[model samples]
Target: MIPDVFAYERPETREGALALLAEHGDEAKVLAGGHSLLPLMKLRLARPSLVVDVARLYELSYVREEDGFVCVGATTRHHDLATSDVARASAPLLAHVAGQVGDPQVRHRGTLGGSLVHGDPASDLPAAVLALGGTLVVEGPSGRRTIDAREFFVSFFEVAIAPDEMLVEIRVPSNPGEQWAFEKLTKRAQDWAIVGAAVTRRASGVGVALINVAPVPLRAAAVEEALAAGAGADEAAQLAAEGTDPSSDFNASPEYRRHLARVLVRRALQKAGF
Candidate 1:
């Protein structure tokens, strides 16, 4: 499938890309690694008049420790995250999840910021960040602002990023020794999860986030509350899908997704040492 004709601009610097985005407004689409947007364009699902390429923004391609969190530049690829020593040491669960996204080729080409901004409920990274309690940093003509992961993901395939805003970085707490687990229930090795759960257990409480269990990536609030209230893993797992609204597809019924949520949450919590 050939995409409709569009102008392509490759900006060498971050500010340049943002400027193009601002100039083109709704007519522009930022290209990171092109894994998500290119497919949409080829399928004619997206038809932006201009394509702003930011994949060469070298400054936005690092994983490092800062303050008490790990700051990952928005253009950092999944393979980079998966193999980054800083990311592995500071946020092991995130590194592990990055390794599990798509396949080797996809990981090499998919950017963390692109995946998050793409706002797919079925993507692994969104739910991982939700469980890790991360924040997104965005910049636009108004300057920079930070948004929590919970607030960033608004609905199915939708995010809080304005048309002129570009996600700059991902900030996740440096939970160096926290027990964490990610369980993906996919039909095939490289497929998207039918249901997935991410768990991070610390002395304070448990953080649980679910993938493909709602229109947006969902935090298992009911399950977390139950865990904090002294209920066992099995008891808390019962509430895993209590507040979620799973989507039914050919591969899974909503009821089946709910069931997988309960089961996967239990297993994930157990792995997290609940």
Candidate 2:
């Protein structure tokens, strides 16, 4: 299928991209890797009048550690994240998850911000970001503001980023001693998870985030609470489906998804050495 007709602009700098976004407003869409957006466009699900390409913005293609956090530029490729020693050292969970996304070709081209902003419930990065308590930095005409991952994703394929805003960076805390695991349930290795779970140990608490169990990726709040209350991994994981309202889809039944969520959460928590 062919995408709807649209004008394209390749911006070489962050400022230029943001300015284009501001100028075109809702009619424009930012393109980083185009892995997600192009498919949606081909299906006519998205038909932006202007496509502001930011793949050429070299400054937004870095993975580095600064201060107490790991700062990843929005345009950094998944393969870069997966292979970067800095990213692996500072955030191995993120690196591991990046390695599992799509195929090697996809990983070589897909951007983290593209995946996060696409807000697909089945995507690995969003759940990992949620578990890592990541923050997104965005730039608009007014300037920049930081949005926590919890607040960044609002609904299915919808994020908190304004039409005039372009995601500029992602910040994740350095949790070197944290135990983490990413369990993806799928029929094939490269397929999206029918259900997935990411578990990590925070300084004073545990973090559990689910993938493909709802309209958007979600945190397992009940499970987290159970863990916080000193429940064993078995007990806490039993509550994984307590608060989620997973829907039945062609790929899975609601009951099956909930069951998978519970099982995957348990396995992930155990694998994380909880």
Candidate 3:
């Protein structure tokens, strides 16, 4: 498949990119790593007239500890973040999930900000961020703002980012002593997860998020509330699909997805030592 003919602009600076976005409005699409958007464009599902390439924004390609959280620049590649000492030390779950995304080639080219903004329920990074309770920062003509990961994914293939905004950074609080784990069930080694679970147990309580179990990457609120109410891991996992709205596909029925969610959540919690 070929994408419709389009004009492309590679901005030299962060402000330049934001300016291009603001200028083009709805017709412009931000191009980061392009691992997600390019495929969509090739399939003709997203036919933007202009592409504002921000891949050259060197200023937005870093991973470092800031305040009490680890900050990842939006243009940072998955391979870079997965191998980053700062990310690995401060946010192991995210680092590991980054490595697990797609495969070697995809990891080398996919951008962390791109994946989050793409809002794919099947993606690995978004679910991990949700479980870690991270935040995303975006810039637009209106200026900069932060969106909590929990509130970022509004629905299937939809997010909180405005059309004229370019995501700039990802921030995750330090969880040095937290027990965390990720479990993904895929039909093939490099395939997307049929159902995925990520868990982080902190002094406050446990945070659980699921991938591909609903229209959006979802925080397993039922599981969390159940656990907070003194339910055991099995009991909490049993409610994994309580508030979810999963659909049936050739790969799995809704009933089957619900079952996988329960199984994966239990495995994740057990790995996190419940």
Candidate 4:
């Protein structure tokens, strides 16, 4: 399939990209790695009149440590995150999840920001970021603002980013040596998870997030509350499905996904040393 005819602009700077987005508004789409947007365009699910390519914006491709966080540039590829020493040292859960995304080719081409902004509930990176309690930074004509990862995903395939805004960076608390684990249930090695769970123990408490168990990637609030109340991992995980609303699909029924959520959350919590 071929995408509809569209004008393409490769911006040399971040500000230039924002300018293009502001001018075109929702008529324009920002292309970072294109893994998420191109397929949708090919299917005619998306037909933006303009594609503002930012894949070469070097200023938006980096991994570094600042203040109390590990900052990752929006355009940084999954492979870069997986292999970044800074990410590995400060945010191992994020690094591990990045390596587990699709296969080598996809990892090499998919940007972290692209995956997050696509807002797929089944995507591994978003759940990882959610569990890590990260924050996203976006820039538009007005200026920059930060959004908590928990509040980023609004609904199925929707995010908080405005049409004229471009996500610039992601920041996760520096958690060197933090205990963490990710569990995914898939029929095939690279297939999307029917259900997945990510757990990480931070100074605040244990963070738990679920994949494909709701309209948006969601935090396991009931499970977290149980843990905070001193429930054992076994008991806390039983509440994994308490607030979820998974849909029945070819992969699995809603009830089945709820069951997997409970099982996997328990595994993840225990594996993370909870």
Name the candidate that leads on lDDT. 4
Q: Compared with the true structure, what per-residue lDDT tens digits does model 1 show for residues 27-98?
A: 999999999999999999999999998988889999999998999999999999999999899899999999
Question: Cα lDDT for residue 232, model 3?
Answer: 88
Misplaced by over 4 Å in model 4 are none
List RMSD in Å for every model shown.
0.8, 0.9, 1.0, 0.8
lDDT of 2 by residue, 1-72 (tens): 999999999977788888888888999999999999999999999999999999889888899998889999
Candidate 3 versus the native: TM-score? 0.97
How high is the CA lDDT of each candidate model?
0.93, 0.91, 0.91, 0.95
Question: What are the clash counts of all predictions, listed in order?
Answer: 0, 0, 0, 0
Clashing pairs in 1: none
Q: Model 3 clash pairs? A: none
What would the per-residue lDDT of candidate 4 be over residues 1-274, giving only the tens digit for each residue?
9999999999889899999999999899999999889999999999999999999998899999999999999999999999999999999999999999888999999999999999999999999999989999999888999999999999999999999999999999998978999999999988888999999998778889999999999999999999999999999999999999999999999999999999999999999887
Candidate 4 lDDT score relative to the true structure: 0.95
lDDT of 3 by residue, 1-274 (tens): 9999999999888888888888888899999899999999999999999999888888999999989898999989999999999988878888989999999999988999999999999899999999989999989888999999989999899999988898999998876777889999998999989889999888767889999988899999989999899988898899998777777887898899999999999999989987
**Candidate 3 overall lDDT versus native:** 0.91
Q: Give residue 89's lDDT in candidate 1 (0 to 100).
A: 90
